[model samples]
Target: MTDSSAPADPRPRSALPLLVAILALIVAGGALWVSYGNATKLAASKEHAAVAPPSDPAIEQIKETLSSLQQAVRGIQADQQRQAERVGDVQQGISIGCDPTEGLSTTGRAKVALGSTERAQHAG
Candidate 1:
């Protein structure tokens, strides 16, 4: 069939894929640039830390105060130990060789005495 009745069309094709590719490349480049900037900042901070910082008087004063507090605590512990030894000596001196009879009530003690007396009478 040879029907020559329609005209030739002259429209361009859609380039959506190419536009998306270019947008992705731009986004990737921006991300890389931000990452590089952060890396440089971290590097600069590390270099500053590597250098020696100036000594502050407040820190030295705090260190001295800490040492004094430690000394005071040690003194208090030594005093407490000496007092404990003295108390031990006093307790040992006051201790007597006797049976303890404080836990039983009066009724319990009477029952125990009556039972002992009845046992003695039966034995006799």
Candidate 2:
């Protein structure tokens, strides 16, 4: 029942081995892709972990000054509110003008206008 003259099944038996090798290679490539993705996510998470300014003394001092200035702004805002409330019965809106170079502290005048309160709230 075997036709030995039919060109020996007309295909190389090594075809099976080649197919298996290709499949193995594809599986290995998928595993490598997954591993690389995980490694990238791990690296990105490490990079995103609450990075901040260096812990140098100068940086710490600057942070402290910023915090103090933020509190001062809150205090000033509260005072302004109180003043507004106290003069609610006045006939006209309050008008106070002074030189920018003389009326306010340099740092206060600079950052206070930049919504430092909101920025500090987030930086906290």
Candidate 3:
């Protein structure tokens, strides 16, 4: 008599369809992830291009203004030096009765005033 309680084929043909379906799902999911990732990168690059301003014109304007200010400062310094030299010459030549302390105080006060005005103008 045949033994009826024997096990069926361990490699069941029924498993093939299940495996194909799982593979298809995995492929679809991967395709979606790649598309979304590319689209996100494209969007970020577009936004960056839109927001960043060109630097050339702004840089040139800054350089021009700096040059003008530097020229003005040099001119003023030359004038101040000339005036100080004249004062020194007068101090050496004129031995008048004017208090030496008063002359020095006046010179110091003038220098302080000039410096403050220059600073205030630059701060503006």
Candidate 4:
């Protein structure tokens, strides 16, 4: 009882194009991530290389001399401090005994004066 003009059933479409698009997006994202990481590493290495080397040998010598000069200045400052402390100690301990006849009796002073006069007379 089928007629010759009956309608045909619809066929299902393949999802291959959608799957391919998803795969392409994943590949692109992975490539982008790898490129970004490589760029960062290259930039860091360049910066380190740029800073690690001196342009001239004279610059290195000058840096060494400058450090030695700083050390010498520190040593001189320490020596000066020690000298100042020594001077302070000497000043604190000092006393004067100006009288030549100190710790002598009056008779001893007279005898010394007489002896000096006798020596002066003999020399003249």
Candidate 5:
């Protein structure tokens, strides 16, 4: 009735945009698929790493060395404390025999006498 649609109007108006949209959608889907695959592969690698046991002997040796050093430090601290106690005991014993008015200045003698008195009080 309209001269066979005038040769189908030569070109469809919506064809080009529709083709572009379809292409864009395909590209987006491909990109998403690629990213998903990469993410899955990364997750699998992490899982494997988590499941694996520690394999380095040097790390274990270092841990053992650190523990030994800690023990040595504790022993050294105890020895220092014992030596300090012995020194304090010797000072108190010396203070008990010495006259506060001889050889030592007034302030020094007072400090030594006070230390001896405090040590005696604490010991008793």
Candidate 6:
């Protein structure tokens, strides 16, 4: 048996395997980091694509058509308003009769009275 009191041998331990393992871990970590970055980029691109407006010409044309239809509807509504105003003016002047003391002559009043009498007779 060797004597326990002898000074321990001073030979340095081989650090090669430990260094290699640490290097491998670092390389693996770097690879994982790169993969994560790439995944993030891909996800962002997908999200952007999902939110992006339509690029198709047909879709654009449909949008334009809808806008034109809305403008046409507004135009039609304006036309209806003008026609309604004209009808109101005509009704006020002729059917309901305007101020009798103004432009209307006696013969016109007699005719209006006859027309009203006829309408009342028809209703009853």
Compare the candidates by TM-score and give the number of the best one.
5
The list of candidate 6 runs beyond 4 A from truth reads 1-4, 10-54, 99-124
Lowest lDDT sum, 10 consecutive residues, model 4, at: 94-103
lDDT of 6 by residue, 26-90 (tens): 99999999999999999999999889786999989999999999999999999999868755664
Q: For residues 1-124, what per-residue lDDT tens digits would candidate 5 score against the true structure?
A: 5786476668657788899999999999999999999999999999998897866999989999999999999999999998687566656766897453355567856876798799999999
Report per-prediction Cα RMSD to one decimal. 18.0, 18.4, 12.4, 12.3, 12.0, 7.7
> How close to the true structure is residue 16 of candidate 1, measured as C-alpha lDDT?
98
**29: Cα error in model 5, Å:** 2.1
What TM-scores do the predictions have?
A: 0.43, 0.35, 0.39, 0.42, 0.53, 0.47
Candidate 1's C-alpha lDDT? 0.78
lDDT of 1 by residue, 5-121 (tens): 643555656799899999999999999999999999999999999998888999999999999999999999999998687556544544763222234468745765687689899
Model 4 lDDT tens row, 46-114: 999888665688988999999999999999999999868755554454444244344447975686568
Itemize residue pairs with steric clashes in candidate 6: none
Candidate 5 positional error at 101, Å: 24
Model 3 stretches with alpha carbons more than 4 Å out: 11-52, 55-59, 96-124
Q: Write the per-residue lDDT of candidate 3 for residues 17-116, one digit (tens) a residue.
A: 9999999999999999999999999999999989977779889999999999999999999999987986775566457744333544677758756876
TM-score ranking from best candidate downward: 5, 6, 1, 4, 3, 2
Worst 10 residues of 2 by lDDT: 89-98
- Which ranges in model 2 have alpha carbons more than 4 Å from their true place? 1-11, 53-124
Task: Write down the lDDT that model 2 would get.
Answer: 0.72
Candidate 4 regions with alpha-carbon error over 4 angstroms = 1-51, 95-124
Worst 10 residues of 5 by lDDT: 97-106
Q: How close is candidate 4 to the true structure, as a TM-score?
A: 0.42
